[model samples]
Target: MNRSEALSIVEPHLTKERFEHTVRVADTALTLAGLYGESQKKVEIASIFHDYAKYRPLDEMERWITTSYLPKDLLSYHHELWHGPVGSLLIDQEHGIKDEEIKSAVYCHTTGKANMSKLDMIVFVADYIEPGRDFPGLNEVRDMAEKDLLKTAWMVSRNTINYLIHKQTSIYPDTFHAYNDLTKQLYGGN
Candidate 1:
């Protein structure tokens, strides 16, 4: 689907604030894609639909899982990370999005997986660096994005892992695996 059509599918599901954030992320992703030589169309589509399941109620998310064919381990992760995969399924089954890159980006946007595609990195970092996000250290990540997309993704993964540890939250193994993989890629396996 085109950008406008993709936006329409997600607009009805997201709150006004989230819709605006998605728009900003799409713009950011496109710019990043241009700089990093990734596919602009994939970046735009993935960014637009990244949070498609964000506003869905917990029960609804759970129900969607019941019908999903995702692995059992993924279903056990109850945090916001689960929304990425769930959103991907919703976009494919409900909205008829068939692009593998777009679906993969959405599926792995939250807790990134090892060896992520360029499109995945774009969407993931775009969401974190979107203008509307004002969390501490975001500016640093923003700068890192401009200077080095892979480095910024690595930093974001590290920060996310640290944050979850600080909160005493259950850490998804995929997140740790992603962080390690990126760290290895960036720091020559330390």
Candidate 2:
């Protein structure tokens, strides 16, 4: 779908602040797509729908996880992490967006998994580095983004883990997988 269509579909599902955040993420993802040679169309679609399920009720998200093929392990994690996986499924079910790349990008946007595609990295990093966000290590990740996408994603992964650990929340396994995979890709380690 086109940008306007995608935005319209997602806007009602999100809070006003989140809709604005989605727009920033779309703009940020497009910038990364331009730099990394990814398809701008895919980046835009993925970014627009990245938070499609963010405002879903906890019980509804839990039901989607249990009934759909989404990983059951998500139920054990904080409800905050459910949006990405639920959003991934809902986009296809509700909006007819069946693109696997877009689905995967949305699936792991919050806690990235191993073997991320260029499109996935674009959306993942774009969500984290979007201008409205303010995290401890955000500036450095934003700077690295223009220079190198992989390293920037790795930093985002690292920073996310660190922040979660500081808050003493349960860190999802896919998050660590993202960090480890990026580290291996960055430093040539197994």
lDDT top scorer = 2
**Worst 10-residue lDDT window, candidate 2:** 133-142
Question: Which ten residues in a row are the worst by lDDT in model 1?
Answer: 70-79
Best by TM-score: 2
Q: Distance (Å) between predicted and true CA of 88, model 2?
A: 0.7
Instruction: Output candidate 2 Cα RMSD.
Output: 0.7
Residue 17: error of model 2 in Å? 0.6
46-73 in candidate 2: lDDT tens per residue? Answer: 9999999999999999999999999999
Per-residue lDDT over 131-169 for candidate 1, one digit per residue giving the tens place of the 0 to 100 score: 889988889999999989899999889999988999998
Clashes of each: 0, 0
